[model samples]
Target chain A: MLKYNFSAGPCVLPQEVFKKAADAVLDFNDLSILEISHRSKDFVQVMEQAQSLAFEHLGLQDKGYKALFLGGGASMQFLMCAYNLLENKAAYLNTGTWSAKAIKEAKMFGEVIEVASSKDSNYNHIPKSYSVPSDVDYFHFQTNNTIFGTQLQETPSVEVPIVCDMSSDIFSRQRDFDKYDLIYAGAQKNMGPAGATLVVVKEEILGKVSRSIPSMLDYKVHISKDSMFNTPPVFPIYVSMLTMQWLKDNGGISWIEELNNKKAGLIYNEIDRNPLFEGFVTDKADRSKMNATFVLKDEAHKDAFDQLWKDAGINGLNGHRSVGGYRASMYNALSVEAVETLVSVMQELERKG
Target chain B: MLKYNFSAGPCVLPQEVFKKAADAVLDFNDLSILEISHRSKDFVQVMEQAQSLAFEHLGLQDKGYKALFLGGGASMQFLMCAYNLLENKAAYLNTGTWSAKAIKEAKMFGEVIEVASSKDSNYNHIPKSYSVPSDVDYFHFQTNNTIFGTQLQETPSVEVPIVCDMSSDIFSRQRDFDKYDLIYAGAQKNMGPAGATLVVVKEEILGKVSRSIPSMLDYKVHISKDSMFNTPPVFPIYVSMLTMQWLKDNGGISWIEELNNKKAGLIYNEIDRNPLFEGFVTDKADRSKMNATFVLKDEAHKDAFDQLWKDAGINGLNGHRSVGGYRASMYNALSVEAVETLVSVMQELERKG
Candidate 1:
């Protein structure tokens, strides 16, 4: 059965990437990819290609931006960003769970000003009217909220440097990549797999803080070594490189952005048209194209709806516990056909009613 | 021709583990291992089994020890240890590059007292005489030094808690696992591959530090969440679990330890007997069973020795720049036959000379 996986993270990746990654595991140049030294010429090529492809996709190649495929996920970046960048104060716009977590870690390094928040509405919408303080070290915000199903479609205009967490929506949309001084994304969603996080930072912005940073947490240390300061997560980075290649071969960000819009359109249109269902987020403009969250209007149709999706070979459609509803996370790898299938299931549920 | 891998780390893994890991990458539980959710029941079982097998091999199961498979490598633990445990001063034995790096990170959190150091001798051997201060937060030392090929056979008798970095030699030998309050190893060595790290910590020893610890850095937080604090390095952890299972199926540490000893004995004896080669470490007792460092008695034999090893299908025998010779790292997966092949190459060099 062809199952469409919609689990938030450690989520779906391209099938071709999986095949190539599997082959590499068994043998890559007469050596198992798992067994090669990270410092070896073969693995070095993998690292270099991965970094270059990341920049090429972002349209930030030959620019001041340095891309690192690091382990420890985006959560580690929460503290590492502060450890290296935050000096006295930083401004943060709290949109959802991840933003709040990033804010918590940043507070340990310096005074964190909450420029705005949408916690009162359980982060159903992105706050737009707040101003970031120019005197602050940097402005931090999440590009997309995975759990709450919200996204900031436009980058905020700020005088100071911008640090954006694009964990869920990176490479899935067209963005002014040069506008942000720093951008990070965990690979589980739109990029590759879990375990590696993609960090793109403008090198000039580092080394300004007075506090001595731990070698692993220091972006300067990693950038100087070309992201080989220590043994990297070899397979994750290779697979990510393969994924970036796949994206590039299929026509970079612009191509994926259009397909992603179509996927989002199919699902969101079903949620709005189906009298049996309702969208989770109150505002249409605040909706996340990556993850479509919705609930059935009539609870009596729940069992039929669940069976219909399962029968359609759908997986990971269950919503997070915090939000008692269904979530259809359509990452870059998720085809429009999968979204169409999901929409058909919803239609079947309404027809049964 | 069968190739013998002697690369320090991200090195050799069991062939069966590699095959299984490759299969899983393609499909595990009807989904790609890289694509499955970490919170899913299938992955949770894997995480649980991996943790249990680690304890079982260490002889620490049901003994108040929690094993965590985390990302960010052992270098991250260099700082995380101090963040979670170092409140006042910690005792360190600076044996080689890794120990010095650990000490450097620890100093950031609190006072680090180097009880002893072999660095003055260029770390050719482990220092025999060192008294750890009882007043310190913890007594820390590396079990196996990969660079210089030195191993501490005995657990340091300390009244304070003990923290050990067993990156190069975990699961290859038996020891009193309960003696150390904390143990961490990068998975690249004896475990599985690069990306994930194994951390075994005594439950009662945590939450003693007064400093505000980042959520990602806190051992207690990871313990609370069962090592799923965030999306873990899924493939790395899964492969580590597979490797652990492989070790257990083959009779665990005692079985591999004896094989490792025979392998070490074969190579070291050949190095000593051959007039062309000289062992790096003078003190036989201080020699590492995992990585055996050695050099040519005459630099004239360098090319000959290099060619001989390569002809015999040996790889990664080049020593680190700090130690300008050769380092044969015989981890758990390396067979005795591989060592015999290496020794035969040494014999061929002597015969030619």
Candidate 2:
């Protein structure tokens, strides 16, 4: 059943990407993907390509930027960032769970000064007008909140080096890639699968701290070794490199952003127009292009709406546990047609009323 | 050509396992394996089944043991153990590179007491007669040294809990699983690939430490979340599960261990008998059943040995950069026939000389 999958993470990859990835698994250059050593020249090329494409797609070439592929998720990055970068204090702008988690990790290393937060408003919007203190080590923020369906489309100017977690929205839009001192994204959304975490860092920002960073958590160590200090998640990184290739072949960031914007526009329009449905995030400007959350105006329509989508061969529409509604995550791999199919299901539910 | 792989890690997998894993990537239960939501019942089942099978295979059931599949390699685990388990001074028997790495990480969390070390002998053999300190939090050792090709054939009787980094040898042999408080393995070695790390911990041992472990490093948090604390290395975890199932279907560890012994014996005998080669580890008792290291009697034969292995369609035979000789890592998936092929190459090299 050729179902359109809307899984928020470990999510949908392009059909073509899947085809090649599968082929690689069986025989990647005559060595089964599982058989190839991470240290092999062929696999090292995969690592190099993954890193280079990451920087190139983000337009981060030769700007003192180095991209690294590592395992664990953004969750590990939360602590790793602090372990290597934090000195006396660091400032954070917390918008959602991931941002809050990052803030928690920073506290373990040094004093964490939270500049702003959106928790009081249920994280429906990205906190704006947050002050970045000059005295802090670095200013950290999540560019997008996956669960709350909001995004900071623009990187805020900070006196201290800017560190951003772009886990959910990395390749979905165009941005001034050089502004941030460090930017990291878990490869589950818009990039590749869930295993490899991508870190694009301005190299000069590292090794400023006095703490002895563990080899695994040290950004300097990973960058020095080209992310080969240990056996990397080869298959995931290989898949990510293939995904980056797909992104390149599909006309890079500007082309992808246009498609994503179109998909988000279609779904949001349906939610606002359909009398039976209402958008979860209150502000129209705050609605996420990646994860579009909406709920039925009447709980009575839930069953019919679910069944219609199920029949339409749709999957992973359930909202997060904290937010009980439907979330249609439109990553780079999701097509405008898939978004249209979801909108049609909503319209059908409204007509049934 | 169907070549045999002998890379230390991110190493070879069974051909049948490769075939199935490839098929799953394209379509798992009619859904793309890469596309499925981890929260979906299907993937949840995969996670649950993987954890349970790990405990079952280790004969750890009803032994207060919980299994976790986490991202990051054993290198990450080298820190994670200290974060959760190291409260005060911990005892360690440093055998080789991995054990030394683990010692380095443990020093970050608390005081570390080195019980013994084999570094004086360049890590060629495991140090014997190391005393376990009762005053320390726990006693730790590596079950197998991948680079040095040394194995601790018998578990030491420790007064404190035993923690083992079995990254290079897990599932290759039967062990007294209940004796250890914790056992960790990077899946790349004998299990699956280069991402998911397998951790089996005694539940009762946690919460005894006073330190606050970071969420990602917190075994309790991961155990509570069923190792889905983050997105997890889904592809790696899924592959490990498939490999575990393959292990069970192929008559489990006991059957695997017998074959491993045979392969090791064949290769080690060839190295000993061939006048051109000499075994690296003097003590047969200390030689790893999985990774067998050997060197030429003279370095002049290096080019010929390299070409002979290449012509025989073998891969990853070159030893680690630290110890430049040759290492044949016969993980569970590596066949005795492959080992025989390597041995035949050794014999041919001797004849040519």
Candidate 3:
């Protein structure tokens, strides 16, 4: 059976990306990618290409934003962001689990004022009309909630410098990339694998905190070293470069947004049309284009519905335990045909019911 | 040409490990290793197996050690070790660059007492006859210095808990594994690649510090989560596991220790015998079995010596700029045959000169 991976992350990347990555493992300029020095001319070129491509894809070229592919995942960024920027106070919008975690770390550095939170409804919708304090050091928010399947479609027009965690939905749609002072995303989503995290930060926003930051956690230290402060996650960054190249070769973020819209449209429309299933998010407008969470209306049909998707060659369709149902993650590499197969599975379950 | 990689990591792994890693990249249980979820049963097994192998190799099984494969490299551990263990003060033995770095981070948390330092002689030998202060929170030292090619031969008989950074030489030889409370090594050397860091820590020594540690930096939190607090560097860990398996299949640490000693002996003997070359370390007994540092007796023969090695397919033989000469890093996976090949190039240079 043909397989379609809907894993939330360390998720599906493009097939061509995998082929090139595997090839590099055997022979990248006559050296195994695993064995090459990060400072060697070849691997340095890879690091440079990855950073440049990140700038190109985000449309932040020559805009005083430095692109760094660092390790420790986006979770590290939650602490580092606060460690670097949280001087006296900061404002945050808590959408779900990740945001709450980010807020928890930020509070360790300084006072955190939550502008708004949607946790009351188990994060079923993105909170709107929140006000950021003018006196706070910066404003932070997560662009998409992977657990709750909600997304903030537009950037909040906050006057203070904005720090955004775009882990689940970065580069999947068009946006004014320059609005945020710092943007971080783990590579597992649409970029590459799980080892590296992409951090695009504006230079001016750093060096504001008075406390001494550890070398590994300080963004300015990494920026000065050009992301080679320590040995980087080389294989992950190289595969990420291939991925960014794939995105650009197939016409950048604008091109993928349309395909993603089509994919999200297919399954979400079926959920609305079929009587057996119900969407988990309370608001349709807040549904994430990357991950679609839903469940069967009748518990009696659960086993047959599970069998239908399993037999149809789908992987990672199970929702997070916090959201207890099914989640079909439609990332940049997930094709519309995969979504159609899922829809057919849902329809077959309804027919059986 | 058969190339021998001697880069001080992201360095050489076994060719068989590379082949298997490459194959898994294309397909690991019906999905790309890059695409699978870290929480999946298969990857969880990989994590469990890696942890168990680490314990088994260190001879610390059924002891108090918890093996964790973490991201951010050993640099992250520098701060984390201090944050979690340093309440009032710690004693650090300054052997070389890495030890100096670890000392710098420890100072951020509290007073750092330098028990001994070999910096006056440019770290040419490991300091001897120094007493670790019993009043200190812990005694810290690096087992191997890759840059200066020096190593501490035995665990110090310190009363306080010991913390170790074995980035370059972990699992390359046998030692009293239970003597230290914490041990960390970057995965690039001997293990696999550059993304993950292997941390083995005792559970009893934690929760003693008053400082509030960040979630990512706390080893206890990572241990509680089984190193899955968030997405891990999956590819690096998997490759590390395969390399550990390779080491075990060939008879574990004692077996590799004999091979490593032979490899070190061959090159060190050649460096001493050849009139054109000289070993860098001041004390022969302090020389590292992992990396052997040496220089040409006369600068005039540098070009000829360089060409001989390049012609013989030796890579990364150039020494670090801080100690300008040459370094032959013989990690666990590096064969004695490769060492013999390097020694032959040294002999060829002497003949040409």
DockQ for every model comes to: 0.78, 0.78, 0.79
lDDT (10s digit) by residue, model 1, range B53-96:
99888889888999999999999999999989999999999999
Question: After superposition, which runs of candidate 1 have C-alpha atoms over 4 Å from their true positions?
Answer: none
Task: Please tell me the interface RMSD, in Å, for model 3.
Answer: 1.2
Q: What TM-score describes the B chain of model 1?
A: 0.99
Using lDDT as the yardstick, the better of models 1 and 2 is: 1
Instruction: Please state the Cα-based DockQ of model 1 relative to the true two-chain complex.
Output: 0.78
Q: Candidate 3 falls in which docking quality class?
A: medium
Question: Chain A TM-scores, all candidates?
Answer: 0.99, 0.98, 0.99
Better of 2 and 3 by DockQ: 3
lDDT tens readout by residue for model 2, B153-203:
998997898888989899889989899999999999878888889999999
Tens digit per residue, CA lDDT, model 3, A76-120: 999999999999999999899999999999999999999999888
**Candidate 1 chain B minimal-lDDT segment of 10 residues:** B1-10
Fnat of model 3, as a fraction:
0.78
Q: What's the distance in Å from true for residue A225, model 1?
A: 0.8
TM-score of chain B of each: 0.99, 0.98, 0.99
